[model samples]
Target: MSMDINEVPSVDPKEEPHAAPPRGNLRKYDPLDMESASFSTHHGQAAKATDWMTILQLAFQSIGVVYGDIGTSPLYVYSSTFTDGIKHKDDILGVLSLILYTITLLPLIKYVFIVLRANDNGDGGTFALYSLICRYAKVGMLPSQQAEDAEVSNYQLDLPNNRFRRASRVKSTLENSKFAKYLLLFITLLGTSMVIGDGVLTPCISVLSAVGGITQATSAMTEGRVVWVSVGILICLFVVQRFGTDKVGYSFAPIITIWFLFIGGIGIFNFVNYDPSVAKAFNPKYIIDYFRRNKKDAWISLGGIVLAITGTEAMFADLGHFNVRSIQISMCTVTFPSIILAYMGQASYLRTHMEDVGETFYKSIPGPLYWPMFVVAVMAAIIASQAMISGTFAIIQQSLSLGCFPLVKIVHTSPKHEGQVYIPEINYLLMLACVAVTVGFRTTQKIGNAYGIAVVFVMTLTSALLVLIMILIWKTHIALIIGYVIIFCSVELLYLSSVLYKFVDGGYLPLAFAAILMVVMYVWNYVYRKKYTYELDNKVSPHKLKEIADNLNFHRIPGIALFYSELVQGIPPIFKHYVANVPSLHSVLVFVSIKSLPISKVPQDERFLFCRVEPRELAVFRCVVRYGYKDFHERDSFQEILVDRLKEFIREEQWISPPTISSNGDVNGNAMDNGEVTNEEEEIRRKEIVGREIELVETEYNAGVVHLLGENEVVASQGSNIGKRILIDYAFNFLRRNLRQRDEVFDIPHKRLLKVGMTYEL
Candidate 1:
């Protein structure tokens, strides 16, 4: 007797170690399930059974991931500010006041309080903001998006109503305008590229500044020797990136904790013994007075002063690793106060020892404590660079999934931590760049200039993007959005101007990096869009496919074949190319399209959508597998899972609409005759028949799943402009050739994969 697909035996939830709890009524409310044809309770929000130990562990883990970059700022901020020279008494108070307010406003007020709320579910970064905007508006750059993409849990937003309907206007404009969407993407990519530049500069400057402290310990230490030492340290840091951060990641918080306590303790000692009166610098009047007295000198000094907030962006970017309360409590109770006291201590010590301005961090240390503090400083610097490198990997991984970057091999270093990914190519490139900058600059002064540019520009871009989120996505009042733009943009643009003034003094490095990376992104996107349009225009219809399947001489092979492409609907033209040459096809054909949506995670139950291509016994079907940028594929046997899901889908479909044998002796359900049903009705009816039952024919287990992938070479058409030809033929082609293959990217085994090569002229 035939059985229902749902009756098929499978692993029990209690036995499945990773199975989530039953959803009960919660599945009814999930937007992802609401839009899909069916739903399962697989990916449910189970009540987490956690104790105090778990919370404490998360808090501790957060310090290492979130605060490492900012915690090490004390190593270099002072030296960079006094690089040009500072006045004896007044400059110290003014700079101290600037640093105090910069930290308070940017990291504490802006990031922790405001920006963290804008996270994509739990993930945070420039791309997170871009994804949020995409959901609210139809501005995603991916051409293959479907209506189901907006059904993800985090993608839900309030529809425009009579009360705050103005947001609809903004959304309409963005969605209708391709240029606006592309421009926003460009800004986001620019910010992302600068963050990678930060990864390069953060190590060179932070390590060099920390190691330079040894100069005061002994006269034998020279600037030349310090550069080499810093380079060696950077080499070691990047060298270990492949091993992943899981082993040392936990130690990060404790190391930073000790460093903060050490700096805070030293600050108190210096404050009490050297100059208690420097406490008055906490007042805003010092900032005002310093600027009035110094004029243009103070304006230029703002570039260096901004260094106090160098790794501030990391506070927001790494929010996915820890909760907001943990970060807030850690920052407010420990990091903020410790950093403030450290700066105050430096200002107080500088009151007497003006000559030690260049090495204030080390020189201000009490003679007995210098060696221990020096060791902590180096450790903190290593942690700082490590945080930056990891953050870069996460952002680039997001970029790759979104089609904004080339395919690269991603290795998950920690099985327990989903976010811990290591990219070998990126690690190697970053290492070389860090060492080159360290050897070339030979001092923190120039690297600081470049570092300042990267930090402020990223901040400025974030500020600009926040305006759109506030107005368009959040639907805040017009007056409030305008006010936010004015306040934040003015501050960031002020810092941008100061950094730009030092353009010749190493500020050009990040700008050059951003430009080169931006060009590569634009060229790749241009070619990708062209190829996508070509596929859509050349797609084969069901009528033509039926004709091919019905031909008397058509050859059919055994086993199931899954043909993968970027197309969301219809058979890809590449299939025709493959069949025309081979003159044969698999008995069971499934066209699968894997898409990365603009959200952080897609529910496992809602990830795959199956549909029948036509009403025929040919066993042709289509499947769309959707994933979010942060989603990780299960490491078990994907073939078994796919087959099970397919069987379940067929059973469900059969229960809903049983198939009938048609005149052609093919299994068909409610087959549409010519002109019998409207095209729209037929489409709706086709969706209803997706899960109809068909017998599952067994095949040799080893050779069962064959993945057919298209290998297409893209080239510009003849008579194209020199620029277009060069970009398409040389630059884009070069990147495509070096990128990882499709089978490797999707974890398809080489033995069962078949390549069908085709060339497209655009």
Candidate 2:
């Protein structure tokens, strides 16, 4: 039943699973009969589940979650370039070069290369990147790197007695790493802000712009109703947040899937109609020609030109779910080539048919009904905002689990769906912000003012962070990256300049909102870190396991008890709470502490450590679970296995007395052997009433007994008859303090102050 200290367990697939039986019901324990804890039936190559198919699904889902913001760029890009064509043409060419470069370079190349690689798993986004980087601070990355000290593990394991070798070895990585914690905090704050900004901005811009497109198509829809319609659409969008993506997400994937095809089809039709030379939009020349023909409006054009890159952040955000290879394949095969053809096709259509203008060019397609397209486009935008909001919620969910946010209610949408998250408070906050944006802005024309600033701010920060990560992580030189980022930042700055000019025009609000959000994220993290992370840390005893093993007579649980620890202790201190509190002595199991090793090698066998706490079935045990980024999940982990084993051990042990009910509601408490209330204690309580934790002399609420049993304390709170109390008090105090001038009896500070003022002291 005990593991040998000299032998190392294999982490290999061939190793059989070790099962711990429950003390009571054997059925409760998982029959770990498998040779190894491998879950490869659904993964890896033998499963026949190609990464490409998953990648494609992930890519299409990204479009559902991400495409609208980027997809709508067609509304303004060609227009921006067209209007700019009337001005200085030289800078236009440069700007055009910049646009092509941003599209091709950022979304296509750099995002696919550097940013997506940082995904925690299939959840790529700013928050994912934040998590990836913050692991240093999260796992005490910096302290582990530099410090001699070790943080302790909070959880205890239920493995049968054995000297844990592999577990101890792996659990040594983040012993005292403070850098991981700090870096995680910093990155989380940044990511939370960007996510929140995107959440609010997405619905406002996406739906409003689609409405703009729709209104242009249909003349009956009035301008004043635009705000109302936009607000309604936003409310509907926020309402769907609770349901999770599995419900409405399927519809969007199909719609967006069709939308892309429609875009391709339209491009083909227009290409056949216009100067086939327009096929050169992909050549990066027409984008050049627009600027060449006119340059005076380069800054303004650049402002609108940035819209095309709206989904650029989304591309990076989704790097986790799909392989980089698949995203590139989609871009090359479906998204990119199609996008170029469409834009060129649209531009070509405009070139020849300027005089023969239809009400909306989007509507002029030959065979189909255009109104439905507008509606679907609106749905796409709603989905876009939904994706942003969902991403925000997901980030906050992870952030909260990491102890970075105030506990907001998080209701998971599906047991099987990891990404199906819903946070009501966030949804409402974003909804309110979005609806306000709709009401205040009125149209996409005004909404655009609130748009570009977010991209510039986030992208600027992203580029800056990338440079840092690349320099620090990849050990690449930062100078060249700094120069390139600076150039892009400067370009972004000029774009922001145009946006700022539109502040009075409606842009200042989102900037203000984003700033407030950033501050909130920082404040939330700062307050929690300062107030809580260290609260339990110092309270726990460091030298606990050896002491527990030495003190056999010490009271403990009958079976294994696993308490999740933030601390990295050999024997978690929570077990000490039991020794000090419980009268029974049984066995103890501490996981010791978990840590990752420098080597990325997967061990031949998985169980890290096995150690004896005491003797036989009454013994204490320990295990240390190690995991990597790809290894994160709610289920399927060494820690979860430990929980299962602990439960099993507890059930199998008969030392644990069955829950015996008292006449009064009580569980764990200091009591007499017979469990009878002592009248002598009642007398002592009346005598000792003068002393209490919180003194309640008299209150609006009933002054019930603030009970104090030795280890436990609670207020027996009762409501006061506020009406009768206030009425009588007000009359009595008025008569005594006001009429009779007995100010002390009045007991109202302001009234007493007024009397003093009336006394006219020099």
Candidate 3:
């Protein structure tokens, strides 16, 4: 008889169903069931503030974490821009106008309003953008995607009838063309690499500029002493990163808030007293006139002017820490105004004291408040560094989940905050890079060149990705998309060209860093995909499994064995290899495949999906444990959860197929054919069976639960080309030997673990 897919079988004895049924069993479980399962238990979007108080509180907190980097830009924007010194008073107005409009257009208009809306379930950064697009299109590099992944709550986007055709066309093109997919991947990796580079340069430049104020305060402090002080501060900043953003953000928020207020107040003082005429910079005509007058000089100065929006990407990158509303509220209400006034005030001060353009921010400060503001400046700089450092950790975590980067230890610093993570290896590397850059560059000018290259390149890549997001995901109008591309890309390209001019003069640092990082990310991803493909292609069949089980010499041990595999369907080849060599199996066998989805978090109830593999009495089951990019699974708790779920599945099977008596007085695994048993009798019998099953499962689990992990070595086949050989044999092997192993990542105890050795010739 035909049965509804969602309806659990009433008396099926040989099979057990699950939300995400294994491949080749689609007929048994409706595709729609999988879709419903994915969305029913999880939130559709990232948690958002529902009240004004929460929004305000988060906005205040964001001021410390998100706005620090951008807020501190005023400290060096003037000095960095007019490296050859300001020629005329109009130069001040021109640069200030550029700064005002750049911040307004890029950070405020483009990012806050537009790109912020493109976050992947409230998580931002280049990888988040890539994840969003991957969900909408079948362009992800991994071949392991299941239908449930597409049906994830936030993965499905609704489109208007008019836009649906266009969106579908875009998706179709991306799926059909391999080049488009690789191009998208390249753009994402490039942007991520640049952000990491910026993470290093930010601490160096921000701290150096802030501490350089010591020279202005007193000549007794040499430039060398200032550099060392900056280095010390940077070291301290990186050391505290292990504390995570929740703690660091709270401490940093007040310092950034006061820094903004101080700069705004001082700006008003300078604007009114020094040159009220500098207010004319609010007009775009000064930008045009100054550019026309200075020509190539003004064009080249964009490399420095771009630094005004240095931390703009941080606002989006750190979105996982705060909601979009909080970011918008904080930026528009607090950050934007304070920064504008700070620039106007600096320009106003420069209008009169053109000779002090090199030291405009400190020179503009009132003599009495110099030291106090200097201290605040240094503190704010460190906080700015905190924003980039935190963002770097976040991006790396996302990369790790997506299989683009090698495994690293990720510590979730706050129990209350899911997104606040600390990577010990990344933190120390950034600290060293920051120290080296600070000591190597010695001045903000050289570091600023490298900093500008990384910043504008990331922004430009964001714009490119956003264009696709607009078309395929947002289903935005073509006209609007074109306008966005023209406006944002044009300005970003101008800044990019200006920065490229300084490639020999420290601009190469970020590029060099990005190149190295890109190679590592690309090589790791290449080998990762190759390895997954090998496992998938060589998976053992059910026929082979039955043969292994039917062998007379094979014995079932009195314990549970969980064989970990990357493949979610058939048994991994390593299992076959293990059984062929060992000649033994556990009483209960579970093939566990841990899959990482593109979203932020998977619901606990929906995390484990159980399916019974054929050969009924063998006690073999498959469990797929799915995790999102931001989700964490503790070692002991995970095992407990898995065991409980297994027992629960056993009880469910017993309830569906209780023992019954046939007309011939024979006990069968179905309800009584003669109606000899009452409903209450059947209920009692089912409960007893469930109790027995649960007890048996508990006993086996208690005896010992062992984790069977594959210790596979990947190598190039003899017939493969030299390039493949080098990549697979040497590069991939080196990374594998150095990085964390699968068992270590899962924190499986050595006593409870068994490694099956094999070789994959790719």
Identify the leading candidate in terms of lDDT: 3
Residue-wise C-alpha lDDT for candidate 2, range 1-762, written one tens digit per residue: 111212223343322222342222111111111111111111111213455666666566656655656665655565543442333323323444555566776566666666666544455665555543433222422211211111111111123123543323322332245554455445546656765777788788777766766666567788777668878988987887677755655567777666677666777887787666544444556555655565545555566667667766766554433345556665666666555555656655665555322222364355464776677667767776755676676666555544445445555565544445677778898898888777776766556656666666566667655654454334444476676676556765666676566577666766677566655454444433332223234333424444544666666433333333323323323445545655454333343333332211112123232332322323444434443222232232433455444333333321222112233533222333464645554334423332220122112012211110111111112353664334233432232232212122112233212211111000
- Candidate 1's residue-wise lDDT over 347-438, tens digit each? 99999998888888888888898899899899889888876787788788777756788778777777765666788989989999999999
| lDDT for each candidate structure | 0.77, 0.49, 0.82
**Number of the top TM-score candidate:** 3
Could you give candidate 3's per-residue lDDT for residues 1-762 as a string of tens digits? 111211232323343442343222222232111211121244454555458886787788899988888999998988889999988878888898899899999999999999999888779999999988877677888766665555455556554356378888787788789999899999999999999998999989889889998888689999999999999888888888888888888899998999999999999999899899988888999999998999999999999899999988998898887779999999998899999999999888888889998888899999999999999999999999877888898899889877899888888887866888898989998999889888888999999999999999999999999998888877778899889878889999999999999999999999999998998899999988888878777887778877976889989899899989877655678888898899988888888888887777776756776666655556787777888878887677777788898776655444233345454544454545556766666566656656765787788898889999988898898799999999889987888888788887788889989888999899
What is candidate 3's local distance difference test score?
0.82
TM-score of each: 0.90, 0.62, 0.91
Off by over 4 Å in 1: 1-52, 655-666, 669-694, 697-703
Candidate 1 lDDT trough over 10 residues, lowest sum: 24-33
Badly placed stretches (over 4 Å) of model 2 are: 1-51, 78-99, 121-123, 130-188, 271-296, 352-369, 408-424, 477-504, 531-537, 540-566, 570-640, 643-762
Q: How accurate is candidate 2 locally (lDDT)?
A: 0.49
Candidate 1's TM-score reads: 0.90
When summed lDDT is taken over every stretch of 10 residues in candidate 2, the lowest stretch is 705-714
TM-score between model 2 and native: 0.62
